[model samples]
Target: MGRKQSFTATELLDTTKRLVLEHGYDGFHLKLLSEHLPGARSTIYQYYSNKEEIVAACMKHVIVTVLEQASAVDETDAMSALQQLLLIYVGESQLHQLLGDAYKINTANSPAAANDLEFVEQAHLTLKSQLTRLFERAQQDKKLRNDIPLPVLVGVFFNLINTPNMLNIPTPQWSELLFQMWIGGARS
Candidate 1:
């Protein structure tokens, strides 16, 4: 047998994310990944049962970073935390867009879908709760408008943050504008 290829799970996920973004979920294949990396297809299969599992794993990798940034926020400073989280959301917009594209394509329906869906639901709930609490605090402090319900407000912010590609605006400018338009009132 040939010597085993040495690689870390992080390296695999990083390469997977890059490949998925370049090829999209439908165009992405395990063979392509194996060809792109220095490992054998069997090595990849050892870590992930299929391409779908790797895609899900890559998303989870990104979600972990989002949560870590949110966790680093000080409890007393909700607005600041919220801003940081929004920036994080913008930073990951390409990954989010890739996931969106993946969902649209009818490809690679692996058994891992159920687990991935569950994990995504939980992560979304966690992120939503954190956002809702911050908006609630901001509302209480008269920093945000109370006319919009918290859930709707959170949804709007989430939708907006994921729209880096749609907006046609520069990232830094778009982020600042997003914060100002969503969190800070237009008049402010």
Candidate 2:
């Protein structure tokens, strides 16, 4: 039988995600990725043809995870669901920054990369729809203030993902604190 692979796809993708977030799409390169991985540089090629493919695959992997977790959230209590969803989004906050560089990826030569980007786009729409649904439900249930426009509230909620965790608190508590601040305001 052929020799076993030194690293799994998840490991490679996870490393790719970290590097991309650290270096950005413009700074990220296959050479840098190989430096952090366990196997030889050629091994990366075996998994992905080029940087575009790898980065696109990494983006797709992240959004897919967020999509899964967001979908699993129960909507019976819209406000509760929004809190949980915020936690999920905060956990993968890097995804928002990563997706911002998606347009820089040239998919002309790589169908796999193109397909992965397409999935990312579709998954983004799905997540947006879910968030909108929850917000509307919450507003209808009178859980949220009716004065502010839904889009404004939704925009602010989404912006919370970018809030700096200056204290480096754990994700669970950080998310909870944010949700509370969003609902209860900063005033004592």
Candidate 3:
């Protein structure tokens, strides 16, 4: 076989993620990917039509995992809890990068993402629900001013946290940078 998938889809994603981390997205191309995994181009295509879909799958997998981890953080100080959540999404230990680049790519090109968009939107709604709860708690506890609505906070918070690469900041700076703005909503 010219293409060898020594790894399963999970393994292929892990390898793809590692390759992306090591070489960036441009370095991970369809030809190169199929070459690394043996069988045929069609085999890899069976799992993902393009390299973009593979990247999207890897990201969606991580995001779903992160939300699950944060599910147990039911505290009045949800923003404080977010500091910890931020670690999973943005910290050095982060698996696929803060918000998953391939997911963003698919979303930005939503017509192509139609297959997974419903599931993705549902997942986002769930995360937003969690954030909404946190904001509600914050307002009740008076840690966050009550003027801002939960839906708005959810939108703004997600947009800020989901800014992909911050472009120039050092790796250590991401969580603090994100939280500073996250905590900004609480200002009276």
Candidate 4:
């Protein structure tokens, strides 16, 4: 009989996400990942053949989670939905940075990697569509300013995920604080 696996795929991907966020795609390697995992280095091969495949899968996993949370949001109240979506984005703030390196992945040799990257691209479009819909609805309701273009508003909203949490506040409170700052602005 085959030996049982020591770690789950989720565990591997979780480590991959953290490492990629810390060292970036160029610096991440199987050897580094194995050191952090519970099994031998060869055990990784049973899951993924190459770094490109692993990273691509990791990126797909992150987006899939965000997409699920974003999709569940109630759009009946556009402003409320926007706030909830902002919280989701803040919770996965590292996603944007991780995806920024997607282009660096050479997927030619690995069909699995190519497929995952394709899914990532589609998920991105879906997320964008959802955000655009919410923004447009909020604008129609006059909850947002008419002076600024919708695209600019959306851009700034997305950029909030990158704001440094210097105080190291917990995710939920930090998300709420950021959402408030986004809506209320920096003015006293």
Candidate 5:
């Protein structure tokens, strides 16, 4: 009887994430991945052509999942949406760390760097658009300051949004403090 295959794209991503955490991106090669993946080298290669492609695919998969889930937030107001998003942001922060090693690989090599940047930009823009709407609502409701330019406000929020994950420091009040800062400044 033929053995059932447990590997999948999802499995690939999960494995990739673990490898990134354990081995770092530079340590994630076919020879290393084969040990953890429980599959043939060709199997890994069948799904991914090379290490760069593998990192790109994994990063894209994670960001896409996050954006899709985050975009569905049903909060009625800016503060609520911000709260909802902060919750999600906190969750995503840990996930992003999986890409830390991949990020080093991305930052070093120009050949594959552009693709990683593109995927990250897509994720960034996705969050930016959602925030823009929330900011507009807050402006109309007098919940946020309107004097600041929309792009600048969004940029500030973006900076705060990435802080926890980038530093690997999970402050219990991180999101709360960030939301307060933005809301304090966003209200008109």
Candidate 6:
């Protein structure tokens, strides 16, 4: 009989990210993940075929989690929706790191790498579509500037999450100032 399941897919993915950060994708393996997680190597194999499959799964998890959180915001308030999504990105620094890793590894000429890129690209499209919809709504209500194209406005909204943190400013103050600057500039 198979061993009882001891870890969840989320737990496995979380461990995978940590291990990837520590050892990098080339150096990671299911054995390492198994040791860090509460399961045997076979248990990990039950869910994934190999390192690439697991990595792809992990990236997909990040994409889905972010999209779900972003989608939960009230659509009636475009600014609030954008701000909430940005706030989530600000809070989850690790998500960007994982995405960076995915981008770095995606150039490899392998099916797994292609799959990884597919997940990242899908995430990008999903975010763009969601933000574009919100921006359109805001524009129809005359809450946003009419001069900028809808795609550009959507790009600006998503760009808010990439605000640099080199100065080590606290997030609350950082987000507040960022939002103020965005609203001040983008408002009609």
Question: Which regions of candidate 2 fall more than 4 Å away from where they truly are?
Answer: 1-5
Candidate 1 residue pairs in backbone clash: none
Better of 3 and 4 by TM-score: 4
Please give, for residues 20-66, the per-residue lDDT of candidate 3 as tens digits: 66666667677776666656667776677776677667666666676
What does candidate 1 score on TM?
A: 0.76
Candidate 5 lDDT by residue in tens digits, 75-166: 58777887778767765665656655554554455545557658766786877678778888977888777887778876776677566444
**Candidate 3 global lDDT:** 0.64
Residue 46 Cα positional deviation in candidate 5, in Å, after optimal superposition: 2.1
**Model 4, TM vs. native:** 0.95
Query: What is candidate 6's lDDT per residue for 1-188, written digit by digit as tens?
Result: 77665888888988898898788777877788888876467888777777777887787777788878876888778777767766776666567667666745544545765776697788868877887787788888898888988877666655776778767889867776777777797566
Give the distance in Å from residue 116's predicted Cα in candidate 2 to where it truly belongs. Answer: 0.4
**C-alpha lDDT of candidate 5 relative to the true structure:** 0.71
Judged by TM-score relative to the true structure, which candidate is superior, 1 or 6? 1
| TM-score of each prediction | 0.76, 0.95, 0.57, 0.95, 0.66, 0.70
Error of 2 at 55 (Å): 0.3
Point out the worst 10-residue segment of candidate 1 by lDDT: 99-108
Cα error of candidate 5 at position 160, Å? 6.1
Superposing every Cα of model 4 onto the true structure, what RMSD results? Answer: 2.1
Candidate 3 vs 5: which has more TM-score: 5
**After TM-score superposition, what is the CA distance of residue 26 in candidate 3 from its true location, in Å?**
10
Q: Which pairs of residues collide in candidate 2?
A: none
TM-score of 5: 0.66
lDDT of 6: 0.75
Off by over 4 Å in 6: 1-6, 22-24, 38-40, 93-97, 100-123, 149-152, 164-174, 185-188
Cα shift from native, residue 157, model 2 (Å): 0.6
lDDT of 3 at 173: 73
Between 4 and 5, whose TM-score is larger? 4
